[model samples]
Target: MTSIASTSQAPPLVLTVAGSDSGGGAGIQADLKTMLALGVHGMSVVAAVTAQNSLGVQGYWELPPEAVRAQLDSVLSDIGVHAIKTGMLASTVLVETVAEALAGCDAPVVVDPVGVSKHGDALLAPEAVDAVRSALLPVATVVTPNLFEVEQLTGVKVVDETGMREAAEAVLALGPRWALIKGGHLPGEPADLLSDGEREYRFTAPRHDNRHTHGTGCTLASAIASHLAMGDDVPAAAEKAKEYVTGAIAAGFPLGAGIGPVDHGWRQRA
Candidate 1:
């Protein structure tokens, strides 16, 4: 007789190495929620913890480098991941440690350069920015950065859509196979650019008139990693992720007092 565990089919496993958002809107919480909604098995390595709510991030604490390493080892040793997404490694040590651990992993990696929170609170330390650019970005399969982060990492401010190409070029120089520049901050239609230094793919969606998109970045990056785990190429994975996030943004509802989050369970609830 086949055991239940053996007979039951398991979904592709995607791992997220990120900070813990006590608010449950972004970071590891959002990543896992996005992965689950996209029909993937989600695992996590908590790199930091944030005392955050809808209003803003009040305080954050970084887990020690050794603790972060232990968590990564425990997950990778027994149940290997098909893909990885990283977010909000708060300190230089954490970033370097995560980068080193991921260096041995062969799965596709999505690096969400989370610099600030939805309410303009800093997530990653100012000094750690260099570590993310020099260490994490180089080993990423795709680096997803919004306009602020693009400027933070590359010193190139994206004032409009035309600056996206330059931002992608700057990010590609950091050694990632693909660079996904999120153009949601622009005034017109929301668009994202996925580039591999040789070719580019553009995904556009009608801008939803919603202000509760707190976790959109984390959600999008995790969705891409989830699709990559399911065997989609970088371009297809990004497009599907964008579609999923657009719907989520459309369905986003009010949470606490300030900005809410994208609805990860929009499909089931809709």
Candidate 2:
């Protein structure tokens, strides 16, 4: 047999700046898993460490701002990311630090604005909300906020799909290039609205009755970042991410004694 040279190119690089989920379901774990499933290389800069499981979060400790900045610098200065996703920035300082770091990067940024966990445990500090709104969101290429997160960030309570446009508009006022309002908490079919303050796109998917959707937010944001790294436009990335998460939610399996996680590798199983 003759020797052959390899011609495979390197995969797109995505970086997640978030907390560490001990349960391997959310935060950094979920981000990396979603990136891998989407055919992208994933890197992480953990901003906090959580004592979390399927049941709930017991406690979490935010990393020092210096450490978080160092990790971000180390990654961006050398490895360089094609897209960046942020979640669970527990404090104002960390949020500002990350925002400052990302302001200089040329890559697309996805902000998940995680305020609480699936079990209602607070993941972000009460004071950090201001920083996220003022600093972090301004630099975001796209901001993904669930209903509860929408209220936290913009005080827009979405009772039904009708209110999603208001929610997206409110988030867009904060300065992100685009806002994606996730209406998964509403009754009936799950729908998400993506808007750039000018054009709007709505994505709807059949609702899955499974309760094992612990990492849906993180997974969705990471998937969007992965698609952006792969060169998809914001609207295209959101559409693909919505499709991916819907399948993952449908394939969600129970874990531990409480809610489980969406299957990141659901596509492989199908």
Candidate 3:
């Protein structure tokens, strides 16, 4: 018999505390896919479950606070994590639960304040918005919010590229170390602003004509966390993540009856 050889090296580990998307376009599914594509080991703590598809989210149900806490403890206690990412925490209890668990964590955290689905379906509860602001945002190393989420969290409505700086400031005031304000919704080229109160970095990409960008938010946040786990600074991670997401968006292909997902494996294809 031939002897098998094995290596001792292991990839960085990234944990995603979020919801599960049945359609496999966003939430935990997208997070894990992004992690894998970026060469990280992906772990998950499902905070909610959604009946979602290309068209819209029909409904969602959050897990009990105790269950969510248990998952977090189980993952953090034994396997450990190099970084963490969060998305679509559906309720106030779950938001508070996850925040409490991550309060003293040493690893970097990426928070995607997901307010609505791609089809305009509500993902985060309106009442839970306060919990996300008071509890969740404070624990984030970096918070990535789209225009709608920026307004939902800070009442800062960003209508153009110029307003992104103000939006980043408003999110930073909520206690995150850095804020990444996504300006994809604005007309013209898609631009995103990253700031840490003092220095600022703007990332812009020519708008792809594709509309199948269902998992862009989750994918970008997860990619940032994966890069952070691999020892990149916040700004460098954001830059690389933006590049990866832009390629994925450009390679997006339609699925189901409506919007589709960005190709998580685009790098591999290229």
**Best candidate according to TM-score:** 3
Candidates 1 and 2 compared by lDDT, better number: 2
- Best-fitting candidate, scored by lDDT: 2
TM-score of each: 0.97, 0.97, 0.98
Model 1 C-alpha lDDT per residue in residues 166-241, reported as the tens digit of each score: 9999999988999999999998998899999899999999998899999999999999999999999999999999
Superposed by TM-score, candidate 3 places the C-alpha of residue 116 at a distance from the truth, in angstroms, of: 0.5
Give the better candidate number (2 or 3) by TM-score.
Answer: 3
In candidate 3, stretches whose alpha carbon ends up further than 4 angstroms from where it belongs are: 1-5
Model 3 lDDT tens row, 41-110 = 9999999999989989999998999999999999999999999999989988899999999997999999
lDDT of 2 by residue, 61-157 (tens): 9999999999999999998999999999999999999999999999999999999999999998899999999999999999999999999998889
lDDT for each candidate structure: 0.94, 0.96, 0.95
Clashing pairs in 3: none
